[model samples]
Target: MSENKGNAFDFKLFKRLMSFTRPYRGIFIFVAFAAIVMSGLAVLRPFLLKLAIDDSIVPKDSEGFMTYVILMLVVLILEVVFQFAFIFYTNWLGQSVIRDMRQKLFRLMTSFKMQYFDKSAVGRLTTRAVNDVETISSIFSEGLFMIISDLLKMLVIAGFMLTQSWRLSLIVFIVLPFIMYATRVFQKAMKVAFEDVRNQVANLNSFVQERITGMKIVQIFTREKTEYERFQEINKKHRKAWIRTVWYNSIFFPIAEMAGAIATGLVVWYGGLNVIGGGAVTLGIITAFIQYAEMLFRPLRQIADKFNTLQMGMVAANRVFGILDTRSHIEDNGTINYTNTKGEIEFVDVHFGYLEGEEVIKGISFKANPGDTVAIVGATGAGKSTIINLLNRFYEINSGTIKIDNIDIKEYTLASLTSQIAVVLQDVFLFADTIYNNITLNNPNITEDDVIAAAKEIGVHKFIESLPGGYNYNVKERGSMLSSGQRQLISFLRAYVSKPSILVLDEATSSVDTYSEELIQTATDKITKDRTSIVIAHRLATIKKADKIIVMDAGKIVEEGTHHELLENEKGFYRNLYEVQFADGGNP
Candidate 1:
């Protein structure tokens, strides 16, 4: 949300934005050509009026009058048709360009490593993708194309005025410099105001989205009154930012109109004096010049306003490209697509830090042989979850090697690597979708039959069938409609249905009641029968039967053995954690 100061628009960024139009160059070229034609047509009507006055009315020729009138009417009709086409096509172009840009940006964001999302604000990123892109749409729709058309109209009208009477044109010319000066002042002021407006709008969107998303927490804490007051303050700033723009409009537009009026009065007075003095000035020339003055000034004023639209579009382009240029995404450099994974995972001298110079996983090395279940038990911040994230390639380790079947994980294509592994996260996120869709994640390859079979295998099929719509029951946003235990069961089924070579369950049964935990235990035993499984849990009871238990403290493993063997060692971290948990009848 950093604002670029001054009236200096980024021409390079503007050019880059225009590059999107390359796909529709033919349409863009036609639109440009239409502007020129429409401008010519706009000027034609005033000329036709001049002809009707001079050659027909003043000369008292009825046939000449009718001929000029009919010609003028034809020009007006043509102008209207082109104007409609121009507006329609320009808007179509704008919507189309933003559509591609939003899709590209979203796809890019999906590929970024976890570090990017961890550091960036979700609400702000959402604004950039949704609100900012919509603003960029206005550039082509109402800003750039409209400005071009207005400029052309002004230039053509100015030419007509000069040709009709340079003396009358001189009156318009004299008033222009003052108006232009005021316009420049007004435009610079508005540029700053518009930038503030956009910032405030982003702030508003971000605030609303975050607040609503976390409304449960707000209501639980009884912070509704306080949050509402804060919202009013943000809303006030938004209103003030807009009112500043309105204030500028209120001041600058009247100045332009007053100048136009002065030019009009001067033209009429000077032309009357010429007629009284019996000079060459005609009523026809004076009439055309007056119309010419309005055409010239109004378009100029509009150009200033529309130019602001172009500038705002450039601002949006700058922010969008900034994200597109980010190097936070992991490079999928591996040539190998390793699909037939043996689920033999090895971490050798692995080290990682979410933030630079502050290690979270410190040189931890471990192995889970094919079909062996390994449980990771650690205090909070002891890197159990970090290990799971690294194994899934969500974040690259600062230093070390991770391998599956003795092949470096980095040597496998990210897609093939992730496809071979399924993770049921500590926080089970479900989309506001049917249970079937949630399990398959809308993946076309995972059919209803496939999901049902997987659910039955995991022993959750009956529980789901007991729900209102069975497989079709909607979970609502984040599974708010389902209990936490129910959501965890769905997560387990989702992972099982993927038919992965390896499974990692991070605190899977932490939220489950006794009944749900028993279901999970059954599901776990069945699911991990042949495939390698890694479980990170605070509840020691869940991992009692794990083939190997790795106890960690302060990001380093302190003990490694089976749950029974680790408990036998009196000084072992696993033994201490076990005593601490069951003694309190709560998680360690």
Candidate 2:
């Protein structure tokens, strides 16, 4: 995320934001009408008072005075009603707009290429989707429509003052230029200040989110004290940014209040002179002008404040739209809707890289015939995982043809292709949800009976039933409550239930204890039977029975044959790797 420069307010950006209101135009128009009515109500009160004082009170008509007071009270009650309507509907507008925006943003993120997630920090993305989206909500709840209402009310007040006495109105106008000048200065300063404030807020959010999520790492490394110092520095930046806005506010408001006071004082002094001089300006007009001047200048003061809020919203919108504007998602232009496959897979001259000019999978080629179990053995960073990512179209290849059933994988719709293949990642992720939901992913078609039967087939039914809630048990965030083996069992069961024709297990048995490994091995054997299975394993013993073994080094296939055939070659890459693991007392 780049720091936001305190540039001029973007009306084009603002106009784009206002388009979200189209969905709630009924409420929008209602709020607009309410602002007009409220402004009229505000203007009417002063007019009624002038009439009450000059006509009813001075003429000594008690009945007329009471009638005028009753009318003012009625207007006051109506004003309160309209104000309530305005506030409630405006807030509704804000909430609705944000809800829609949040959904759109999340949907966009869901389609982004895996490479995008690889490069983006989890904390930064969270800040954009959560904090920035929330800030934009203020445009409706506090910024845009509210500012419009205030401006409308201010204009109405000015009009009423002029009708009362043009000369007195001119006197009041003299103070406005100073107020306007101050407001202009305040507006520019606050725009930049708010940009800084919002940026700091995102940084603070990102820092805090990362720190909390990685607390275990901090504790294990004994870096808590160092991290705390770092947090304090970031926290200080956030505080300093906010304090600047508060400082600007303090300076601007007092100046506005003083200016309003001076305007009223001028109207009072000048009006008093006219009344004493027996001129046209009356005491009734003077009293009304005082109220009118405050009404006029109060919104002028708030306009500056509200404009800063608008600036904050614009800054947030700019960040969020940055994400929406990215075209990094995998291209899914394939029109073929293939839901089933014979599972014959081929990779021809495939090349890929996470970064430009740094190919991680270099012109690799391999094939897995239907019902064949092919094992890929490689050291870390040998691009074993990158192969599976490309096969699933999580990232596009730099140059390659990946085919299933002799049709380019890109010739199949992403869903049609992915639905036919299920990947069990090395680092399995489970949502904070029930075991059943995690396994079924809330798919309406995958029933509890289906999960249970599949779990039984995988020899993990008893394992699940032994838990306190059995399949209904809740796995707290990221399946933290479950052991590594247990989570693997759940992941295997999830893939089993999906019934994908092509199954890829990426280091499924690498990180678990012996008992867990045995359970996963049993489940893997059961699921891979008659399915096109691609298994990447660290243990040579796991892939011994695989029909073919492709040994990779530095992203290239250096040895290709069965386990026994590769072992027969004394100097082959697989033979050497196997001997090294055996020498290290590792599974071989």
Candidate 2 — what's its lDDT?
Answer: 0.91
lDDT of 2 by residue, 407-475 (tens): 999989998899989999879899999999999999999999999999999899999999989999999
Q: How far off is model 2, as Cα RMSD? A: 1.5
Taken over the whole model, the C-alpha lDDT of each candidate is 0.89, 0.91
Q: TM-scores across all candidates?
A: 0.97, 0.98
Q: Largest lDDT belongs to which candidate?
A: 2
Q: Give stretches of model 1 more than 4 Å off.
A: 1-4, 585-588
Task: Return the lDDT, model 2, position 69.
Answer: 99
- Model 2: residue 183 alpha-carbon error in angstroms: 1.1
Deviation in Å, model 2, residue 537 alpha carbon: 1.0
**Each candidate structure's count of clashing pairs:** 0, 0
* Candidate 1 residue-wise lDDT, 291-370, digit = tens: 88888888988887787787678778778888888888677898788775688999999999998999999999999999
TM-score of 2: 0.98
